[model samples]
Target chain A: MTGTEADHARHNARMLRIQQARAKMQARRTLERGLLIVHTGNGKGKSSSAFGMAIRSIGWGMKVGIVQYVKGSWETGEKNFFHAYPDLLTFEVMGEGFTWDTQDRARDIAAARAAWERSKELILDPDYDFIILDELNIVLRDDTLPIGEIVDFLKDRPLSKHICITGRNAKPALTELADLITEFGEVKHPFKAGFKAQKGVEY
Target chain B: MTGTEADHARHNARMLRIQQARAKMQARRTLERGLLIVHTGNGKGKSSSAFGMAIRSIGWGMKVGIVQYVKGSWETGEKNFFHAYPDLLTFEVMGEGFTWDTQDRARDIAAARAAWERSKELILDPDYDFIILDELNIVLRDDTLPIGEIVDFLKDRPLSKHICITGRNAKPALTELADLITEFGEVKHPFKAGFKAQKGVEY
Candidate 1:
């Protein structure tokens, strides 16, 4: 319970003012174009968040191209879902394995290069409205491809195409150039308790 | 180009080791109870991630119940998709608007209480395998209802039902109680550049 009728009336008046201001701000935002989005940090849901975006893009009746650079070998639930929608989505598992699994540095680099080449082909396709470079930052972090070179290549990407990159330690250059970047920070996780990641939850 | 045939063989051996460890870890994690998930912080995608979970849960042939606590006024893209699945999903918009729009603190509290009551009903229903308390953290952040009370009530929730609470600034008590907690940190945002959050992206 707040206060009297006068307090309620005052609050209502303030809300009106705020709504009007928001309307003005909303109207001023007229430009609509593709966005470079990055999801990075030391928490869970980085890849899942990108997969969420991929799902929403399909919800909008748009085609999505996904290049899984660091998580290539595993069978994921999201991948299975995408497989059901062959017409709207193309999911390519390009990485040899996780960094720990693919311990050889040179092999990892080669896989990253191949994945980037596939990304380039996907980005060039006018049919795709959304292209997800899943865990691409791990490749960049390994120096398989220079972050600057990727940024330079994406400079002239289609105006209406949105590209999302997800991983830990996204390059500063990419973050600066991105229209939106979200970092998933760890608050608490089951892994700390030695609870291994299960199929549906982890994948 | 990476390395020779010998290098490839060595890499494959490492991959096998990693896979065996992962498999052992996976086998040890046998707890399959429904998750109490919290998605919070200043960055975007908290709600969308939960919506993504709802989608995935549906993919598993489970019904989902959604209560939009603070974001009831706006027409969201996800809501539109859920509308098409009347038989499977029950999306109830139980708030007047965002707290800013509904500036009366008393009214906001009342709305939150009403929504919580609805949530209780959904949580009790065995038919719903997944219940998303979308933006419930924002309602709790305002101290309308005690966060501890909510967590206490959820402690003995259904064994097979998963509940996801999403919003910014989730209370420490709730986070501690949650099985999984993901905090979205802002690295970059379009709003800072005066670009409006568009449909499909923001909604």
Candidate 2:
């Protein structure tokens, strides 16, 4: 309703140029290796995005492993849904709870260590194609886990195993080694509007 | 290994204070309503994260609806996975293709309008609890669809129906009206490192 024939033709020509440039870019991008994807920042959807990737992997019949570092005590919707895919997905909940809930540094450190051990096993395992270290960044941010060892181990993981680490305030070292880093910045939240977290959405 | 008994006691006392404050804050957040979530910016996982929320909603036995505006032509893993839940989901693919691939302004607008019509139906449908409008922002950014009418319709949607709109460059008007807005910013990407999109991970 808004474009003239001349305008349409001009738009078509501009799109043709873009299509050709995209083709050139696609031709140059030939490398295919597993990526270290990091999702961090003070926003929602860090772990949700990882879980979504897990579903996508399961759609293609690829094995997925997940380790929760700081959100294990509560029964979440994602957990219940992922439990349906035992053959294709292995989900390990290893956190005691949120740091505020736990309130014990020693116990938090112990839980982080155990979760990291499990994560390392998943990374080294040949059967899994995708592994999600859900909220691992929280542990790293609090210095509950050793970053150097974790980075070294991740760097040496299987060439075709995609690993996703998620949480707010990801360590700079980890982001430096990541192939993809998506910082989920929160522009607004319901909590600020005097609303509590709802079921099937916030969890 | 990191703290003495006195230090541990001090930490526990500090945490108690924080917990008390948290409880007081929680007491104030009592409102409950559906959320209008927007995922936007130039990064990966905007749509993937919305898909994840759909899975989370499904876990809680909630019905879902999805409309793919610009991604309907491709056989995405998400589309394939979501198709498994025919009983609980209404999946609509109503795009000719990407704008470049279509290169027809009139056709793109028609497809966008058609998709928006379907989206409105889903939003107003009482049976559906969650609805995802995938890549709708692209068409909005291109002015293929009328934003004012769409925004008005969305603002008047059911109070208990959660809606997620995902894509890059989301309209400022939508963000201003949204309950939650997560901007997914890309710090690094595999594509920049000469890596082509993978099967399960990318699609």
Interface RMSD of each: 3.2, 1.2
**Global lDDT of each candidate:** 0.80, 0.87
* Local accuracy of candidate 2 as per-residue lDDT tens digits, A1-203: 34587788888788788888888998999999888999998888888888888888888888999999987456788988989989999999998787777788778888999999999898889999999999999889878898998998887888888999999999999998999999999989888899888876788
lDDT per residue, candidate 1, B74-114, as tens digits?
A: 76667766786787689999966875677776788788899
Supply candidate 2's per-residue lDDT for B182: 94
For every prediction, compared with the true complex, DockQ reads 0.43, 0.76
Q: In lDDT terms, which candidate is top?
A: 2
Q: How do the residues B1-203 of candidate 2 rate in per-residue lDDT, one tens digit apiece?
A: 44576776777678778888988998899988889999999989898898888888888999999999996347777777888999988889887788887788778888999999899888888999999999999989988898898899887889888999999999998999999999999889899999998866688
lDDT, model 2, position B4:
76
- Pairs in steric clash, model 2: none
Q: Write one digit per residue (lDDT tens) for candidate 1, span A128-183.
A: 98899988998888676788889998887886788989899998888878899999
Cα lDDT over the full model 1: 0.80
